[model samples]
Target: MAGFIALLPLLASANAAAAEPGPLPAGWVAAWSAAAQAVPPAQDAPSFNRAPDTAGRTVRQVIYPTLSGASARIRLSNVFGNAPVTLRSLTLGLAGRESEVVPGTLKPLTFGGKTEVTIPAGSAVWSDAVAVPVQAGRPLALSFVAPTNAIATTWHKLASQVSYVSGPGDFSSDTQGAAFRGHITSYVWLDGLAVDAPGASAVVAIGDSITDGMRSTLNANRRWPDRFAALVSSSPAGARTAVVNVGISGNRLLNDSPCYGKALKTRFSADALDQPGVRDVIMLIGVNDINFGWMPPHSGLDCDVPHVRVQAADLIAGYQQMITSAHQRHLRIFGATVTPASLPADREAIRTEVNTWIRTSHAFDGVIDFDAALRDPGTPTRLLPRYDSGDHVHPSDAGYQRMAEAAFEVWSAPRAR
Candidate 1:
């Protein structure tokens, strides 16, 4: 009895320390993330134009394949906004079907102990850590209300998942889906979600539409990165690694596209290197550059701004720059061979040169032969008939699965160095 009484003080102190937020445990790492891009209302789908302004309204965005964790934080971006954007409230919870959130799971999110936060233009902010239990491959809903008017917003154009917006007022805390009437395919404001997963790191997949899963089933989480995430989560090293998709549709390595974000070299720092706990990057870009290089001037497929025509050598130089940048950051970079795309013979020649360089040059720490994985053996320049999503550009679901498998095999293999 006397010993028990003496130990009470020590036990209470330990409990208090555990409850207080401090430096994250060494084991904690980023579980999931998405790159953000500025989208004009006019460029958005017709459904997205319904609610151009977020003033006094709540937007609920559902994210699939949230890696499991004991606690998590959300990242909000104003990277493309011309003016600061103020968020009045933020909430997170396990998602129910569609826009609804599971009851008894809703939790408030704050930034530096405050519910309201203003993210400056061309900047981003991470919310303070909160206790929110999450599971691997599950869906999580992040809801936020903007009291101040917001016009052009930073969003992920190819969410491949459906999200919702409330009519008016602050409905961020509501667990029911009734208040959400407007629907949008893009994820607004929300950029990335990081969870405190012990003994875990992350890999970022940076690329164009192929990596973006343009042809995959909507809301199905069938993107190659998503598939890779599932594979890593269930592997022997599952507890130590996570995968984040940073692919941007229509993105290029040498030229900027109005619909997509900046070129790979311009945004590599933010999209790949800056991601929380990112240790490796898998880059599979350049198809767009090859295709556009072959297009006639003012063919609508070319970049809006005229620039030096791109060639295989120019793209190889771009890859070299990316490799150097990643090396400077002490990150292991893997080069993924550009996939098969619908292009003329001239452009196909360029792609062949790029792929050969990627595979033999040894410029990258490793190589992922996505081209070999998806290309048809009979016609090496075209995607396999079963793998082609009918466009001859993007791969079908089965093709994505194969690509994921190839990536997983490389990731699992013992590194040469």
Candidate 2:
């Protein structure tokens, strides 16, 4: 994920609320999701040019759902664009090697009974439900074609999943991926995949890059949330539970970034609460807010613009706000202690103070001590060597598994319900 923000004068506010989702459809749950961020404009930075051009191109993306259903729907976003985007065609099917779709599984998708859709700028829409069998842990491919000159201005910048783009034409119905000549590592336009699973509920894992699975193996689905979903499915009582991730890399609890999307405090409602069938949330944030203030500022794109230093009380207040909001929605919220990230004495003190409250205050319905699960016994302030993802900040695959285990122990306990 780009750790820096863009230089543009904060164009259109990507944080503007989309139209109210109204009443959620009954018996439907979010199977997968990626928080949407406005693509940084092309400046001198190479990181700003990551968004793929979608004009008249067929983009196929692979997504894995944690629940099964006989019908499904998709959510698309144009929230950061200045122009309307028209999808001339869209299709879904079981995925095969690379970008290929399994034969006989491909089906067309429509919006409001129409074969195409035009999303207005700064808005998003959910497609009409399509009768398609969805399986848990199975990969599904979603392909769409933009017939007009449409650039991907809004997207999940660090999908950690490989998506394919076809040469200039509509290949939404093709069973083969030969037309798909290029590959991208981000998800464009698409933000969510939902399935009609009665009685099934979801757990949203929200936070910063750690939850976003940054530095995890690409296309491997080894994110801690992904591992947690697997554990949920294997347990006898967890068959009906789903987990969706809305973590934006470099996200903060109290502040927003041009590249990292909105602050957790500001975007929680849209990214987590608004998700269909959401019944629980597990949040791990504040580390960035504590560390970003110390990053040296550069000339062009200063992502940490405000760089406001925070204290334990400041972060505690943020946590209180989230806990209240989750309870107001009648959902159980779990707090996660920030994992070890080798830091200076001052920052480490802030992290320790914040984690102490998360552990002792009982502010949340439950607590997941990720810091304890991954920290070195000999060096409590650093991640265990095996857990460190080479960088002291993020976790390796084994480290992510430990995190999932910690969450599963708390989430699966009889009292947690």
Candidate 3:
């Protein structure tokens, strides 16, 4: 009864292809299903092509990236739109490279097309599971002759975690077969994927914009989450846990609906919590609250204010609630201490209090001190000067690397996950 919300599995069918999911450990339970978060439309500035209800953006010749080694039975997102949307006149092909031609493959994707998908204005709908082999480091282009009438291009990258191309890469135009010639960054949905991923173990990164890896090199896809995933998947440290980022820019643990999160991509509960094989969650958000935007110090004071800031009790409660939610699924929830904030003294104080609370709280299964890793040795609460990403709020590429290293050192340890 206590704040319970039952999530129905993404609409799937018997014919949908599924991967042979590896077994869980002794104490593990499959609470959430593995599915990519986005049902993206067109990709531009990470925008969702939107129209009004009863309309959809029919991507002409689109290619979407798939989660590696995944099955074909997957869902799609129409999450960001002003109304219900539909994807039709479809053809599916294999991806060649960064951006190029779509390669014709033996495989193809389909749906109950006659029954158009009605993505509620505010929510997305998953397609009936289809069989598609998601290649590691490869993308699947979904081609169609139609267009969504009311197109609110979605944040395809947010969920799919793959890049799209205007044309196929490393392949010839003929390989694409039809109508696909140009190759720019792509934003389309691919099938043969699922949520509650088929993970041996999963890593859930929880945090703010930094963790969101905003402003990182575009199309380079070098966010620490991707790096961490690569690191965890290879060589000495390779553990079977899947890595999923649940960081919402400017998000606060206590503020479920913070203002910074209002404008950008966020699927916190569904992307991080509801993901399958997610045994661990690493939170790394907060900063804009402290920096307080251009108008430094509200009310003419020397400091800014976070109207939605979740101070002490609120933070504690938020952490406890998140952990409790994870526990119900028998998931192990790890608390990551807030990283250093590059704000003035008062803001730093608030961050320090929050970090301290995170460290001392018994509510988490474990605690990760990212603060210690990214802080300047000289100034414990400020992002290392060299790592600062211009704004003094975010991290540079090196800073992100430091952030990644710090987080990995803690969460990637044998003892933690």
Candidate 4:
């Protein structure tokens, strides 16, 4: 039993490799994704010390999602890191709880057959595929030890899931969670996970906080994308389609946020077009561009953006650029009308204009009317009382479900010939 358990991953890898018969096939579909961004140490950073000098720690991140195949690989990014960082070791396994890996399910991960890997600044590397059968909608854990001090780390601040970090030591193979000394809400080092899904393709949801599931229950997989994933997994498309979320909490369509990284136009290629097996994109952005444009120049969020005022025209042009880029990659793009939000008159006008274009424009391959889905029937500019998450900007779990249903309708529609 012990020997068979240890050989499970190896055998799965051999079977997958034999089926593909060459370099890893292009059929790798993203099962999970968190767009990498630089989180300011002093603002919204996780409780743990995220500075580069914090090293010699073993971290275990639990990922809750299902993969499509028996063989899988992980992608680690240093896109926001200022210097190279060495990962001393890495491993993956089925999770038993918050930080514990199920005994005997843990498997070592390697890059080019080597245990140690140095990820250069502003880039990412995918580990060699391992035979780890992951069930759809299940949880998996990844453990790694950082041997050297890091000066700057690339991470996604709003993981919406709890991850664990341990005291100085290489605990990558530990099956128990007792050694995890602290907890972090954000995901570090990890960015994406892909699996050999044969005919499976993916739809990448590109947007801002609402798409990121800001007010939804944490670690519950209540994001609209998660809801969409559930819908896809049970539909006729279930066996062939997956939904991947690439949203950043404060992301904007026209301008860049310091914490969220580049503007949608600049990061679209990396976050959406470049993902494995991506056949479509559901873009729901622009509220930030409208809301932020109305804020005073001295507002802290204004410092990261240029002083120019953004208008609906500028935002539409940005969407046009994104559409062109997606088309260049032969990926279908679906524009999502921005959801309702209470804003000042000027910003509200811009939102109205942008949403109108998204509905009337023929530029997008298709349009998902998210605005119509969550808006209050009596007061069109505000979210439904039940759907509002209290901020009036984000949505409640009920609202996210509605948004998911709206998107599913468009996604499940018959493709035009």
Candidate 5:
């Protein structure tokens, strides 16, 4: 009787402890990410016309996470905005058709325990972690209401996924989504979504339009990184790996464009190395650096301004710099051969020489032969007929899949930590 009475206090204490909320899971892995770019002027491209002010409107963006977790957080960027932007509210929910969300699954998100957060210009903010069940490959809709004075100047220019915007008020919490009357293909403000996925790490695929899935079917999630994530999920050795795409359309290896974001040499660290729980990098750039120099200057918004010609040696030096940076962070970086872009003889020679060096240099931790995967057997400088997306440069869905397969065959997930 005395022993039983003594154990009661200890048992009650344990039960009390169990009732209290525990800390969020430890490992934070980037489940979805898009490279942010300054909103180009209307003169740069017609798509910029769709870039909304977002003031007093609800912007709901859909993201397909590559990793699953019990809790998650989101990253909002004003990195290129000229002024600070205040958000009124934020919510996350499972996506339904068009702008609607799954009933009863919507959850509010707070920053530092507050409902509102002001992001200074040229910066980003992360929302506090919320207990939301996330599944790999499932789409999550993130909705945020902007203040009346907010002006959106930072966005992922080529989101390749359609997002929604509401009419004149805060519809961030609207599950029916009837108020979401506006549709945009760009992801404004929102850049990244990370989940507390323990034992999982991310691989960031960084490059230009090809890696950006420029011509892939909209809202279909058929990018090479998307396909790579699918492959990782099925492989027993990499079941816990996540793939993130940080490609920007028209991006270059050495030069920044007025329309495209910063050069990969400049943005590589911030976009890929600094990502949460990233362990590997796969880079496939240089095509633009070789081709942009030949584009004729136009009357307005000449994005390919410098037209600085680069040789195989110049491109090789850029790769060496990236390799050094990746090694400094103890990351395994893989070099991806620049895929066929149907270049002329001069540019084709540069591509061929650069690819040969990439395959032979042994400078990167490994190599991914994207060229071999999509190139025509007959005309080596052009894409295979079945793999071309009709735009000799970008790959079709099958080509993206083949690229993913090539990576998978050489991929080795980070060693257990």
Candidate 6:
């Protein structure tokens, strides 16, 4: 009893152990870029949902990347809007699109003064973040109730993205099952962001092959940034980093490619800064520019175009310009070291030069070495044997894991500032 009393005296009281606020780390950043837009129903296609297609159209996945620096303030987009779009009601609930069905559990979202919004031709609107539980593998339903005379665009001729569709071939309207089968009714959504939330930030991940998880696992969603999301969610500190993957395959930083964000200067403001919940920029690109640049029928193709060789100086300038834009918004810019390529001797030489510049440059807020993280310990120039997805150019599922590990390590780590 005396020993217990002595221990009690030594024990620290909860009040006595009142916590102290240490130096605050940088805010968590989000990365979400609007890709497709939906419009009110038109006479030709009044009610649009993904329909069955023989050309193998299906709803692969629906991704909603969150942002940081603002809580409760969320924005949604179909940035690649081809025409007028309309959305009636929004919901965020268990997709139950294919595997399961949980009825009557749809959540509604809102904005300024109306639930129904009409986006003009070639434009988008941000959704006011409706509080909802958004997690991976959970698809969302953006319902449009009685959307009349609406014209919108989904993924069309988009061989790079794996989204569910209603039509055939195009990610547009034809999909695996009847469009009504996955019918989200245009009035409900599963989960939407809370952009108005205080203390939220977002990081836009811009790039080509690497950002898309080209060689990563199928149906596993093991992309590097996805893994980073898990890490951040589980971490006491990483709770702030909202990593968005804006990488489009075959995309170029300076030119419009089949699978890329536009060039460094043009896309900087759109893909990164324009995001609703954004505060930081983490870039992983340039490899495609090196390899695909040498190939024919490129994303930004032009017959008999100049056989110009894009040099390191050009890339450096692009990086400088992108960083400057982010800086203007008080956002931190982190340049990623370019990864290695399995291209011909000449192309490899160009890649080496670009990577060297990324590592050496002191211009970026920080450097994420995906090249160092995914390369073979032995060869140094190729993706690790196990990480290779058959093509020497892309990473295997494991390779994406390695990429995720590398990025998450930094994303989850305490901020340098």
Top lDDT prediction, candidate number: 2
lDDT of 5 by residue, 1-417 (tens): 999999999976754443222233459888899999877675555655446757788899999998999989888888888887888678998998889999988999887666777777887877888888999988999998877875677888788899998888888888887899888888888889899987889999999988888999999988998998898889887788889999999999999988788999999998999888999999999999999999987876777877889999999999999999999999989999999989999999999999999999989888899999999999989999999999899999999999999988888445322
Residue 394 error, candidate 2, Å: 0.5
Worst 10 residues of 1 by lDDT: 15-24
Q: Give candidate 2 regions above 4 Å deviation.
A: 1-21, 47-49
Residue 288 in model 1: shift from native, Å?
A: 0.6
Full-model lDDT, candidate 5? 0.87
Model 1 spans with C-alpha error above 4 angstroms: 1-28, 41-53, 295-308
Tens-digit lDDT string for candidate 3 (147-211)? 33554334323332333222322222234333333332323332223423443555777666677
- By summed lDDT, the worst window of 10 consecutive residues in model 2 runs over 11-20
lDDT of 6 by residue, 1-417 (tens): 998887785553421222111112233233334322222223333123331232332222344444332233234444455554455544334345452223654455454445655554444455554555554334443333423343233332222323343432322222223453342212111112333334656667777666766656554567666676666656776565566666655556666532233454566665567654576678887766565556555332232122346777777777888888888888887788877666677877777887888788778887888888878889888878887788877777777778777776765567734
Off by over 4 Å in 6: 1-61, 64-82, 88-90, 97-101, 108-115, 128-139, 145-196, 258-261, 297-308, 412-417
Report the C-alpha lDDT of model 1 over 3-121, residue by residue, as the tens digit. 99999999767544432323344655666677777674454345543335566788888886436788888888888888877887789899998988999999999876777777778
The alpha-carbon root-mean-square deviation between model 3 and the true structure, to one decimal in Å, is: 8.9
- Ranking by lDDT, best first? 2, 5, 4, 1, 6, 3
TM-score of 2: 0.94
Pairs clashing within candidate 5: none
How does each model score on lDDT? 0.81, 0.89, 0.49, 0.82, 0.87, 0.53
Once model 1 is optimally superposed onto the true structure by TM-score, how far is the C-alpha of residue 376 displaced, in angstroms?
1.0
Worst 10 residues of 3 by lDDT: 14-23
What TM-score does each of the candidates earn?
A: 0.89, 0.94, 0.70, 0.90, 0.91, 0.71
1-417 per-residue lDDT for model 2 (tens digits): 243356232422331122223445799899999999878766733664457867788999999988999998888888888987788688988999999999999989887666777788887888778887999899999999975566788899888899899988889999998999999989999999899999999999999999999989999999999999999999987899999999999999999887778889998999999899999999999999999999888877677766889999999999999999999999999999998899899999999999999999999999999999999999999999999999999999999999999999999999997
